[model samples]
Target: MKSAKSETLKGWALALPLLVVLLGFLLLPIVMITIVSFWQATEFSIIPAFSLENYEFLFGSSVTYKVFWATFRYALITWALTLLIGFTVAYYLAFHIRSSNVQTILFLVCTIPFLTSNIIRMISWIPFLGRNGIANQTLIGMGVINEPLEWLLYSDFSVILAFVHLYTLFMIVPIFNTMMRIDRSLIEAARDNGASGRQILTNVILPLSKPGIMIGTIFVLTLVMGDFITVRVMSGSQAANVGRLISNDISLLQYPSASATSVVLLVTVLLIIGTLMRFVNIRKEL
Candidate 1:
């Protein structure tokens, strides 16, 4: 009992720093935000009186619903694209590539683009997607269309494209790591049992890759949901998401409204993560 107690004390000693940090940085901010969310905001200043007006206005506005729906649209589309592309790349890297050295090199290649900041990568797309940009010029040169596609840039397409470009690696890395942990013998056994490639992929590989998929989903969703800069720049203000809504409120000095929106977003994300966590055994991955 003494040894157990001593070990427990030692573990608590090691973990205390992280616990303190979480309480100070994470929990404290959330508590403050929740409290401030009920405050009143005026033209120039915030009033600390308890008020539900912020939330009432937020829920009453049609724009709020539209913005949230748009945010979900962005997340859903990005998640689907990232999942399909990430899974394919991870599958190839995990199974098809025989050499471990080659896999490492290729995996490093996947991360090369991320070395630069997301803003740079997002801005880089503007050159390629602009009216007279390479995509339009190339298409025109190939007689695909005579006119430049004006909707290419500063639109949802550009926003989602930039999203996929920036975040696909997040999806790939986790899925690849998870796939690498899969036992090769199980795959061979499935093959020996006369399972086709499609069957094996659908049944053997995909079923085992759930933890990684869930992890990657969480990462992608969290990033996409909280992102304001990417949507603002890439969409050229043509789009409005919940993040941009919060940003706009903050810019207008509507602190209470911003806090309320933030609380809603936080709750929304937590609910999603909780739902996904139900199906995934994260311990297995750990």
Candidate 2:
């Protein structure tokens, strides 16, 4: 009984710092945002009074609906691309690479680009994708096109491409971790049983990789949903997203409206994550 009590105390002591940080940084900010979301916004200042006007305005505005649709579209595109590429890369690294030294070297090479500033990395693509840039020039030189590709820059395609470039690493890391943990014997056994590569991957690898995929999905979705800078910079201010909308509101000093929008976004992301969790109990798999 005494030892159990001591263990409980030790656990609580270890958790106390994390609990405090979460309460102060996460829960507190959420509560404050929720409270602010109920307040009234005016031309000059936000009034500290309970009102549904913010939500009402948000829902009644067609622009809000369009922005949300665009945001979801971007999120979906980024998620799909990242998952596909990440899974392929991770699979090759985990299963195909025979030498651990070579695998480590390749993995490090993948992470080298991330060592630089993300903003710089994002901006670097502009010159490559811009009109008269490397891509357009190359295509033009090859007589592949008469003119530079306008859709290559400052468009949905560019935005999604940038998102995939930036966030694919998130997917790869988690999935690689999961894949590395998989039993090699199971794969060998499947092969011995005359199971093809496709069959082993479908029936064995994918099932075991669910936890990592869930984690990667959560990361990519949340980051894409909350991102304003990437949308602003990559889309050249032509496209609107939930984050960009919230940013505009904040810039205009419409704190209440921004808070309301943030609340809505938070709820939407939570719903997505909750739905994903229903399909895969990540805790059990982990």
Candidate 3:
């Protein structure tokens, strides 16, 4: 009885710090945001009165629909690309690489992009795609193009490319961690039983990695949906996203509208993550 009490105390002590932080930072803010989403400010003040006008404006406006659709479209495309590339890279690292050292080296290389600031990485694309950029210079020098391409920057393509570069690592790490935990003998047994490489991957590997894939998808989709800076910097004023719309509203002291937009985004992301979680045991499956 004494030992059980001591262990319970120890567990409580360990969890206390996390519980405090979660309550103070995450839960508290979320609760406040929920309250504010149904509020309207008077005379441009910090204090807001409770109302449904914000939500009414959000759901009733066609502009909100357009912005949300744009955000969703880009986010989905980015998520799909990240899943494909990240899984392929992680799969190779886990199964094909025989040496632990090589695997470590490759993993480090995968993380190199994350070492640099996202802004710097996105800015780097500007020079590469500029009229005097290396790409244009080489193309012109080789007579591949008569003139520099205007479509290189300030376009949806540029926004998607920047998003993929920034978020692919999020997908890779989870998938790789999950893949590493998979029993190697299972793959060997499948092969021994006359399963081809494609058969093994499609049947054994993918099914087992569903949890990781779902998690990575959720992360990428949510992050991309909320991002505004990358789209602004890379695509200039040509591309508009939900994040940009929120930023614009906030800039004009439209807190009620901004909070309403945030609520919608939050609910949408949660819905997606929740729906995915239902299909797999994210923790144990991984």
TM-score, every prediction: 0.98, 0.98, 0.94
| Sliding window of 10 residues with minimal summed lDDT for model 3 | 41-50
Q: Could you report the Cα RMSD, in angstroms, for every candidate shown?
A: 1.0, 1.0, 1.6
lDDT of 2 at 109: 88
Model 3: which residue pairs collide? none
Q: Write down the RMSD of candidate 2 (Cα, Å).
A: 1.0
Identify the superior model by TM-score, candidate 1 or candidate 3: 1
lDDT of 3 by residue, 1-286 (tens): 9999999999999999999999999999888888887777754775667788888888898988988899999998999899999999999999999999999999999999888888999899999988788888999999999999888888898899989989999999989988998898999999999999999999999998888888889889988999989888888877788999889888888877788888889999899888888899787764
Per-residue error (Å), model 2, residue 278: 0.8
Off by over 4 Å in 1: none
Q: How many residue pairs of model 3 clash at the backbone?
A: 0
lDDT of 1 by residue, 59-159 (tens): 99999999999999999999999999999999999999999999999999999998898899999999999999999999999999999999999999999
The lDDT of each candidate is 0.95, 0.95, 0.89
